[model samples]
Target: MESVGITIRLFGAFRKFGNGSEIEISVRCGTNLKELRVLLSQYLRENDPKFSETLVVDSAIANDTKILTNDFCIEKSCTLAILPPVCGG
Candidate 1:
């Protein structure tokens, strides 16, 4: 591990990424949400190769119940919830 870690939470159809509701991942200090996404993409490409293209498939990133932006540097380790896209009949 390089620095502190963060938990990447998955919901809805995004559960395939972690094979469950949540998964813990490590990231280097100063990593932003966008960079974290890149790390996640790599992780998926390595672990869940099939779900690589479906990561949330269009989702929102949240931290402590608040939405996080690309520039939001993840200085503190915490849980990030990824809410997948909604679908209806």
Candidate 2:
């Protein structure tokens, strides 16, 4: 299976994954947000001992324009942002 590299900009708690704010992840072609989330969560768990599964479940994935639904399929390599749930009062 062919795969593409996707660059995801980390936000909130996700920034703790590495020294940089962005990380490149490779996914099989035609992967969607739901699948990507699982892959990312696994990657995080492997890379960071403090990673939590709920973070990926609660986060939102957005392209240059808007937040994408889990069913949205990514066909090409691109830069996207993962915005973790935010709370402000």
Candidate 3:
């Protein structure tokens, strides 16, 4: 998995993996963030049935240092942060 080298940081209540606030995931190089969301959704739904919705919609992804669209292209191994939707009145 080290060869893939994609680090994901979970924020809010997204850390379902039970390993602090960060985790390392593997994905094919050049995979877009949207595609990554689908991959993550599949895993989450299988492990935690409650998370049926894909991350593409349920959360925002911070690519490197900026909040980008799901279609943002991931060129190399980098750190991504998952932020649950902002809800407040």
Candidate 4:
């Protein structure tokens, strides 16, 4: 299976992992945002027992330009940001 390299920029609660900013990972060529979320969740659980998969699921995936929907397919190498939910008044 062909794969592509992707960089995930951490935000909010997810910033606590690795270097506290970004993470690089490989995913299948046609992997969509929703599938990527599951892959990320698995990665976190394996890397850190305390990592919360729920956070990953609730996070928004965005590229350098804009936020992508769950069905958006990643076709090439790129940088994506994980924007976790935030609550403020």
What is the TM-score of each predicted model, taking all chains together? 0.80, 0.91, 0.77, 0.90
Best to worst by lDDT, what's the order?
Answer: 4, 2, 1, 3
- Model 3, which residues run further than 4 Å from truth? 1-3, 54-56, 87-89
Residue lDDT tens for model 1, 1-89 = 36987898887776766757788888888888778777777777787667654554367788766887788888878889877776768
What candidate 2 gets wrong by more than 4 Å, as runs, is: none
Worst 10 residues of 2 by lDDT: 11-20
Clashing pairs in 3: none
lDDT of 4 at 17: 78
Model 1 error, position 20 (Å): 0.5
lDDT of 2 by residue, 1-89 (tens): 88999999988788877666899989999998999999998899999778789988889999889989999988999999999888879
Would you list the clashing residue pairs of candidate 2? none
lDDT over C-alpha atoms for residue 75 of model 4: 93
Pairs with steric clashes in candidate 4: none
What TM-score would candidate 2 get against the native? 0.91
Per-model tally of clashing residue pairs = 0, 0, 0, 0
| 1-89 per-residue lDDT for model 4 (tens digits) | 79999999988888887699999999999999989999999888888998878888788999888989999999999899999997868
